[model samples]
Target: MKTFLEVKQLNKTFQPDKEVEVTALRNINIAVKQGDFAVLSGPSGSGKTTLLNIIGGLDEATGGEVLLSGQVLTGLSEKELSIIRRDQIGFVFQAYNLIPVLTAKENIEYVMRLQGRNQEECDTRVMEVARKLEIETLLNKLPSQLSGGQQQRVAVARAVAATPKPHSC
Candidate 1:
């Protein structure tokens, strides 16, 4: 399978006020292929979240490189990275990070709107994901109106709805 995401020789460290260096990641490397449902499982503070953050472009590495597809993410400007993240990547966090005021459907549509996807595509993807996840009935319900699982399902839908760019985490 072709590589969809690649991390090579990645490293990240935290320097405390006392000047103690804490290594969060060290020479870490991973290659996830297209359509791979890969999971980074480990104990707490085991660098799973740190690796994900690097993949998601939410955190910068102290060294090394991440190439999503053939593009080097570290070289991209913040604005460009933001657009890439908004348009291509989908994030499913442990928490349901949804807007309490927005209905399930609206929350799903938010990313599409930000990406300027046409109404038809947005509707199609939202409906497809909602149906696939059996959340169609909760489309009009706010985050507060749904159960934890339902909200997380919606979050997953929103993330997967976007067609990823040539390479996205």
Candidate 2:
């Protein structure tokens, strides 16, 4: 399989003060092949979220490069990155960033709606993903109405629905 995502010499640094520089990641390198699952697990404060943020284009790296299907993401403008994120990537944030105003079904359909999908298509995709994630019963519930696990399932459903490839979901 071809390389789906690659991170080369990745680094992230946080500077709270002029004299304090904390390095979150350093010289990290990874390559994920198409259709493969990679898990990152470590102790807390190990930069797992930082690495994921950089890979998802939600945060910037201080050095090195990230490639998604051969497109370099290191230096793109926010607009360009947002376009890629909307069109190609699916991210499930830790906080379950579902809209407070939207019900579970509407939250799953949000990305498809933003992509200009018709109502029929969005509805169908949302139903399919909700069912696949076994969240069909929770579709009408608000984020606040659901339990933590249900909310996470809804978040997964939303990301799966928005993904360009269902296989990846």
Structural similarity to truth (TM-score) of each candidate:
0.93, 0.94
For model 1, how does the per-residue alpha-carbon lDDT over 1-169 read when each residue is reduced to its tens digit? 7888999999999987757999999999888888788877999989999888888888899999998876789767889889879976888888868888899999988898888889998888899888989999999999998888898999998898875533454
| Candidate 1 runs further than 4 Å off | 165-169
Question: Which pairs clash in the backbone of model 2?
Answer: none
Tell me the TM-score of model 1.
Answer: 0.93
- Backbone collisions counted per model: 0, 0
lDDT of 2 by residue, 96-131 (tens): 999999999999899989989999998888888888
Q: What is the overall TM-score of model 2 with all chains considered together?
A: 0.94
Q: What are the lDDT scores of the predictions, listed in order?
A: 0.86, 0.91
Candidate with maximal TM-score:
2
